[model samples]
Target chain A: MNQQETGAGEIKISARDVQVHYGDNHALVDVSVDISDKMVTAFIGPSGCGKSTFLRCLNRMNDTIDGCRVEGDIRLDGEDIYAPEVDPVHLRARVGMVFQKPNPFPKSIYDNVAYGPRIHGLAKNRSELDEIVEKSLRRGAIWDEVKDRLDAPGTSLSGGQQQRLCIARAIATSPEVLLMDEPCSALDPIATAQIEELIDELRRQFCVIMVTHSMQQAARVSQRTAFFHLGQLVEYGETGQIFTNPSDPRTESYITGRIG
Target chain B: MLWLTFLIIVAAAALAYVLNLRAARRLWAEGARLHSITTFHALYALFLAALPAFVFVVLWLALSGPVIGALVLSGLPDEVRAGATAAQENLLLSEIRSLARGQAFGEPEPWKAAAAARLTALEATEGWARLALVSLIAAAGLIYARTRVSASFRARQRVERIINGLMVFCSLVAIFTTIGIVASLFVESMRFFARVPFFEFLFGTNWEPQIPIREDQVAGAGAFGWLPVLLGTMVITVVALVVALPIGLFSAIYLNEFASPRLRAVAKPVLEILAGVPTVVYGFFAVLVVAPALRQAGQALGVDVSPNTALAAGGTMGIMLIPFISSFTDDALSAVPRSLRDGSLALGATRGETVAKVLFPAAIPGIVGGVLLAVSRAIGETMIVVMAAGLIARMTINPLDSVTTVTVQIVTLLIGDTAFDNPKTLAAFALGMMLFLVTLGVNIVALRVVRKYRELYD
Candidate 1:
């Protein structure tokens, strides 16, 4: 387990010296890391620590931001995503993302889940689309509650249910990697528990990278934890060692709630 | 003299401000804590000094001319006063006024010369008297205001109350102006209805409002039916909407979703400038360019086109309206949260699909409200139709046929030397009343729809 950064799980994404500059401000500095597949890799730090910025970089989400410039190399499964030949629209379908807020489209619950599959031509007919929606909802652990009223607006759900719906929306694309940006920050304890359980179940199918503010969440749900502070990746190791025996003073100070 | 009086009032107010500022500062320094700030105390003193004097001066200026006229009228010779009728007396007064101005008309009475001299003396006295009174009132008001400025004086509260009253007055000014217009329209419409049956005017299709002005002139007993006029207005409105809706909506979509920041920065203001381009200019464009082009196109296509085609006016009006509809739609699109845009884009949906599927549906209420408001505007538009559309009251929907709209009819009926007592002139008022009601109804519904669904996204 201590042999290499890739270890046994197999590298899903490998990045070297990835620099993110938002206009004059250099937001992320020389971040180099290898993330394994079929596991939850958590990025944790205080606010404005570039944790979310790194998560967005995985899917090229930073392309949408004005004045944001990305430098260096980021590869998903030996393929450079930022290549000129690659379309962001096509790449986003392969790398799905869930935002911190439960931003369900102002549409019915069924339409919300079916949106990704429909756009990507995953369904051959109406019934196939319906099947995809039901399967996605079931996998999201929200089918039992929303099965009877798929016509209801996605925004009509509780905060926790909405987050789960967002998860369903993300996975409906059937991407290889799922990026979750503080998915539990807007939810209560129960909702957070449900999402944590879902994350564990989801690790079998997709490579998951999440940005979390709570150190406990990173420790509980993640096998690998990366600590970021002031746009720098200060530490990266096994979650247990990072929390119990941090190698960096900043990471130790942050974990003990001394400094952010 | 009036401006000099104004200068004195302003000087008095300034003096009051300076004096009260010193007084309030002394009170604060003497261990008596002030209730309001020093500037507010000074402003309060200024207002007290200026307001009453201003009111008195305005009243005195208004009353002095009439009072002086009455005095001059009474001073007329007994023979002239006793024999003259009211009209004759008014004539004599004007003649005397002109004589005082040294513009002596052809032969004048000797008593008029005496009266003009008296008028000059009275006018001079009136100016000096007003100035003296305004100074005295301002000085008294300043002294009284200064005496009232104690340590516990709530000068800020008083000044704030005055400000609140001024705001209320301004709002009432707008409300009352609207009410006055509606009331006058309604009253005049009722007068028109006394001569013509209300239902007949509303429902009858024949809208010939060309009644004979003189007994010898040959003219029909003008029918006041608004149906043809109303139908023509509808035709033009439909044509305008057809031309404007797609262009405006697509432009808004492109500007919001696809255009680069640099293009948007340059384009948005240019679009707004289109809105600011005077409607009269649009009218000229319709008459000088679009009308002639349509006629030639119609000739080439072997179709009969009127010189003043409704299509010409309606299409140019539509061009004029594009910026309005586009800006409104752009605002509604922008008002949708950035989170939704990010959500849709992150789903791998292209910008077009995202705007069409997610943002357009979300912003439908606002867009519909804007369209309805624009419809009302099209109905109320005057210059384009007056410049390009026909004056004939034809009951035809064909865009190529010459047709008259309500606004065009109103302009024609009101501009000439037609007597208001007849149905022809009164018909314009009736048409105006109808136009007002229809547009008012549309605007109300539009506003209500926007307000009702505006909170759903939030």
Candidate 2:
């Protein structure tokens, strides 16, 4: 893949020739990307195109899956995340994730928001933890709908609210990068719109990396877009340029709905 | 003769099946659309022929013995029958029966010989009557069923109804069997309560059911307090739980969370094999191995231990119960969705913290239900306590002291030749009633806990 020229911005996460394998299946091959800080970078591809696999490698979420092996250097802010001293548990706190399905912990809404903060020791006491929870919920844009029932179970929320709750839970730890793997896939259109707006807002604080199947969603919320096809990064550039200008035939075919 | 009749009935039913199938096929060949397949009509006719004949044979077999005995008694001479008690009448009937079969001990009495001849004649007549009645009923049913097999006859619905009725009947048999057991226990317990006051049996500490075997026997009035026995059962159950619960739960957690697929495939069944070992074998192990080892260890530690202490029995019982708790707990833990585990881990919780704070709480209700089930099993366990725990019924909390459970007491009370009417043997029934109630209460609680908690995940 050719490195597209871009306006200068600080790189938050730099992946150099990353490859992932699941047993005999070659899932992602020699994928390289430089994700900028405080911007939304969306990875778009068809189903089974390794977009999600490459997203999981950002936070080491792939470590949970059996028979999955990740190789090559993935550095976060110039630090090797795969170093022996880097614990996946601690790495996940710094690189939070939102799943495709809105998987809220089977706990109270307040407890779900407080979980990451408590684990990362971000708050000193109960009041401080409550403050963090409120801030995260508000930033997730679900505070008004759920603030009254903070004590209610996280699973009791509607699909949109649960997805928002999961987002709040991820950001509560104050991570530098938020990895969202189709966070709006399981929500309705209105919920998806709310999440898209929240993603635009979250980009001001954290380097938001999302894997979405919707090309329109990538165009709407992302500053930089990476199109992955068949275990390779086919195109990476400014969102407007990738959608309009000619760079690769596969990218143009995918954008114009000719090939996916 | 009964077996021959049964065989004839079976043959008649088979012939009905063939005839009905052919009739249905003939109707279909004659350009009439049948509602059901040939097999349904065949089976319907077969059932119609077989069931009525079987019922007739069963009824005749049941009534023939009493009717023949009553006839023989009524025909006997007035001198032989005068003022005979029920027991005497039964004895005379048995002698007559044996003499008719030519198995009399010596030369039969004159009256007995006459009665035997009469009984033989009655039995032969009964056999011929039974055969004729069953065959007549089978033939009638076969004719009626064959005539009903028409082109549009709903034979399939009729057959399905019969099958549904059979299913309901089978279920009713299970329910009636349970009711029968409870009723028998209740009646026998009431009889025992008549001899020993209910309050005394429930509240009294002593439980000595001294049985008087002879008229001149002295000191046979036994105390029947149940407190010590109940306490002993509780103590042993508590000890078993203490030994089994933590170990079983932790092992279940490890097996569910930490074990690889290769290791789990081999380990789970090996652990379950412990449950498959019969309790009687566990009893033998407790008696021959565990008790002596515990006794020796206690002596070496400068503490006196009874040979049949609750510790030994309870420890072995606990070992026997480990698989029960572990398997149930493993099911409960594994039932927690993988998504929940992923959510916890993604939030950066360590594996131990994830299990301790999230998985454990989520599975608590199921785990409690499993533990309560294990408790019921421990309380009802018999062979292990009987073979290893002593016969002494002492109310003590000390595990090293020999104690007896309700089951062991029941076994001791009912063993050997004993009169059922006596309070000593009857006490077993009372103990059984208590054991049943306690276990039933535990099981109901466990079921409720499981049902109430199962909603959390769904």
Candidate 3:
């Protein structure tokens, strides 16, 4: 629950005094946080609390939005992402993002998974590309259901399947970190539980940072949880400690269902 | 002319109002509330008086004012009775009214003076008639409303039915108009095919329609092998598409995907200005500037060129078509969901890559629709080709050579002095029917393609 920069492990992403403003409204204040390598960190807050904004900051997805200004420095493994030498295209390849809504490209499932790898030249031959596609789909854990009809449109699948396909597409390029923005908000309870379990399995390979409104989801899936409110990081600690034992008033209220 | 319908509506509305009033009052009386006459009885009396009273006054003002003046002009004393004949009385009244306005009547000085004197009296009578009409309607409406004061009325239901009827009438107008257009086109085209041999018109290679002037001489047999004209139309239309499709679609891509918001705001209106320009001006530009330029360019390239080459006409027509392609392309591109773009970008695809691979493929149906519509426009284009491309019947594919299109041939055939009874004049209708069918075919295909795209995405 305090400003502690613990550099005990190799940090994958580091932020220093990051501030974001959308038009005249300040979205993120003078704040700083660091993400450790190969771990799942969950962001929980009320709607419009800027948890999604901070998550998008990792890969510079905020660049797509007009009037959005990022003032502070963000670095991916020690390189300044905002510097003149950095190419956004190259940077996004290193860090991939999934949206709150499961948006699959209007193409076959095979094409959807292959789109990123093809553009980045990750595979040398068609056979290599095929292998990579199958591997990505297997890792994302929807291969058995979709393996029979790879030519079917990705949108034809159920919502849970589509979300998993998007995850597979994002990881096809072998990015170092994966960003998930409310990935379960559009899914049913069964789909949500499936995704929560998948997130747990995914943490063993990639550095995962997710934004969720469900406090129980954070407790069940994340090793560490960060609480955000009104564009400020109010608390960050072990999930069990934050949920049951000690935290700021806002974090306690939000966890106990008293306030958001 | 349909004024009687309004009277029927009014009667029905009055009946509804009365029923509501009676029902409401009955409920109130059950609760021991004292009331005036039941609403139905009051409304009934009001309508009985108001309908006749208002109609009576209106008829009086409309009919009697002029009649009275005409009676006075008949040169009888004021004590004389009015005539039984409506027409004679009306004539007399008009003359008297004219005289009162300080105009002299036809050739009798004493009679003109007498007519003018009576006209003044007729004006007062007309004014009274109008007053009586207004008072009668007002009194009737007031009395009917007063009767409802003591009872509830269902005004809402009556108004709703009238509104629903109006809605139905408006909807039918749209449906009937569509039916009318198709029927007319079908019948006219049928008449044209009957006069000319359908097989000869469709398959013949030559199209020279000249007929005889006098009965003693042999008539020039109208030759209409449509192959040349159809070929010419296809050639020019192809050239136009080649010129327009690239420039228009590229500009559309640039505007939609690359341009800043401020730049787009300016460029869109400027590009749309091409649509507002009259085709006649484009025709002149094709003839005066573009034709000469194409001839020079062709000569420089070591090729023989005609002054009215298909390339010149097609190129200018394509310029005219720029707005058509760009606007539709802009719509097609914009119609692709933003979420699709987001999905692509999040996976690290570059803008150019995303647009080429994902956006353009998704918008293919809409873009094809726009191109087909542009093809129809190019085929039907007359002014530019008439001025820039020559009127020859040669079937050639070379863009530098002078060519004639179906529309240009049609214009030339129908304009010069020609006998209407001969096959020469009627040939225009045959050509028109062909042009209509081509465009109709294109529209149907375009609509089907667009519909298929809609089903895929939605």
Candidate 4:
């Protein structure tokens, strides 16, 4: 697959010259990428290469940081995110994020999944909220394991399970796009493999944009891969082409693990 | 003088050791080091020669100055020697020595003048003897140190061990001081308990310590029930918590979860400014502002107005305690992993929902600990109550009515002249013991909750 062919896929989120600055640091330079609907897009780069910064841009998470400024345009399915009338809070409901570490709320497993649906008034009552919780947990691929322990604290789960639970929580509101910032980095090898498989499966329903350090994970899970270095998007193409053959030597060097 | 000499010797020894080590390393690295003994041995010789010389001089100065003066006084006539105590001898010898050096001693008596001449000679002889002894002892120590020196000696390791021991001694001093305090409080409390029944004092309902002044009046008939004071303390603490908890927790939530960095920077210090204001100032505010406002409000509400109401004092105290709870809650809420909030927000939950449902619950243990600490501060508070609350120990539960706390009562009992044997003063100790025990219990529970939460989270 080539860049032109991948660009033609069903668009979920489109960014045009998205730039991010943190104080004096130019974190994300002029970058443009279109994330596909019901497909996974992976951002791969070296440490401090602004892959996570770009991911945060999708959900306006960078707004939380002081001295962070985002320029240019990011649109969710043709809706302008940076518009003066846009509410970041409401925008975050449609575009959710999962962090690198498994940070389960100190609440019970049921409450953790029910939290999103309850807050958005997605469920009518307690029983409706209960059903949403069960469905989300099941979709996250951990309901069978934690079904009997729904009342237990979310933090009581193992790392892999907690990550899955976080995924469950993220999907509870049935968000249109999911942003994961190195969700598997803090996990063990087996957990990373599990999450990679889950990401591939999640692509059937939601658009997934993953920022990862692992090239192998990008190659295995994402349909499209964007290579970043020094805060610039260097190359973006079909995952196979980005892994097997590339237009740039820098991309080749990064894919072959000769240099970050 | 001895301490100063010891300090100087230690400083010199440390300096010699560093220089010797560096010189040894250089020579050894150069591959032609030529010394029969190790480098440390040279340092040891310098240290031994200097330290003992300094210490011996200090010791001789401390001893001989008094000895020669006493000898000169003993040789005087009995009548003259009658006034020759140690201090007088020292003054007389110093005076006579100055006179012998052609200085005037006012109008010197013939016997004193004669004694002064003899004392000057004795001082010179004694000084030489003292010097000889010091030099002999110093030489012996240096010889012993030299004999102990060898090529393979581990002087640095020995010195390191001695330093490590000194560090441990310094650390233990703090622990011993705490133990000493506990022991003293325990003894004093025991002395109080011997006079009053422990159970009655613990579960008392009254507290009046007016002692009889005249012989015709009854000697000891004051009630010492402490329940009213305890109740007053509890009521005030409850009122303070009611004022503090909601404001403190919400502000913490706002700061931790919602506030932008610029807003946080501006707001945090503004909130902490409450903490920097002295409790005495808070007391003044409670008395001058809050108490009057409360009294007027009570009257408007058609309730009986008490000028020194617990509501006013406790309300101001709680405001003073807001920073404590808010800062602690902020830390606790902030400590909740970002992953949790992100997870909830990603699920399309609003920030408020994420905080209310996830962050707040997760931070419960820490928040509770903070609240507990604040409660302890409220219970042990003295100034605000002293200024705003009345001195009457009424066993009423009305908020509009005046009440006195344990701390205020203790202050009133022991502030003026009173015999230690009187129960009026002894009751203060008993009250102090109770207050200490209660606060200590709260701290222990708070620590336990915090530890349990940490273990669960980690």
Every prediction: chain A TM-score: 0.96, 0.95, 0.95, 0.95
Ten residues in sequence with the least summed lDDT for candidate 3 chain B: B1-10
Indicate which candidate wins on DockQ: 1
lDDT of 2 by residue, B224-324 (tens): 89999999999899989999998899999999998998999999999999999999999999989988999899989999999898998999889988998
Instruction: List model 1 lDDT by residue over A1-260, tens digit each.
Output: 33222333899899899899999999999999999998899999989989999998988889989999999889998999888998999889989988898899888999999999988899999999998899889989999999999998888899999999988998898988999999999999999999999998888778899999899999999999999999999999899999999999999999999987
Ranking by lDDT: 1, 2, 4, 3
Give each model a TM-score: 0.91, 0.91, 0.78, 0.79
Candidate 4: misplaced stretches above 4 Å? A1-8, B1-164, B213-220
Worst 10 residues of 4 chain A by lDDT: A1-10
TM-score for chain B of each model, two decimals = 0.92, 0.94, 0.66, 0.73
lDDT of 1 by residue, B1-458 (tens): 98999999999999999999999998888889888988898999899899899989989988998899989999988988997888888888898999999998787788999999999999999999999999999999899989978888899999999789879989999999999999999998999999999999999999988888778889887888899999999999999999999999999989888899999999888888989888899999999999999999999999999999989999998987888789889989998888788888888988888988899989988898889988999999999899989998989999988899999999999986788788788888999999999999999999888777665544
Cα shift from native, residue B50, model 3 (Å): 18
For candidate 3, the per-residue lDDT at B75 reads 61
- How many pairs collide in each candidate, listed in order? 0, 1, 5, 2
Instruction: Name the candidate that leads on TM-score.
Output: 1
Give stretches of model 2 more than 4 Å off: A1-9, A213-220, A238-260, B2-61, B100-102, B117-156
Q: Candidate 2 at residue A60, lDDT?
A: 86
- DockQ for every prediction shown: 0.61, 0.54, 0.49, 0.48
Candidate 4: Cα lDDT at A134: 92
Candidate 4: deviation at residue B436, Å?
1.0
Candidate 4 positional error at B66, Å: 19
Which run of 10 residues does model 2 chain B get worst, by summed lDDT?
B211-220
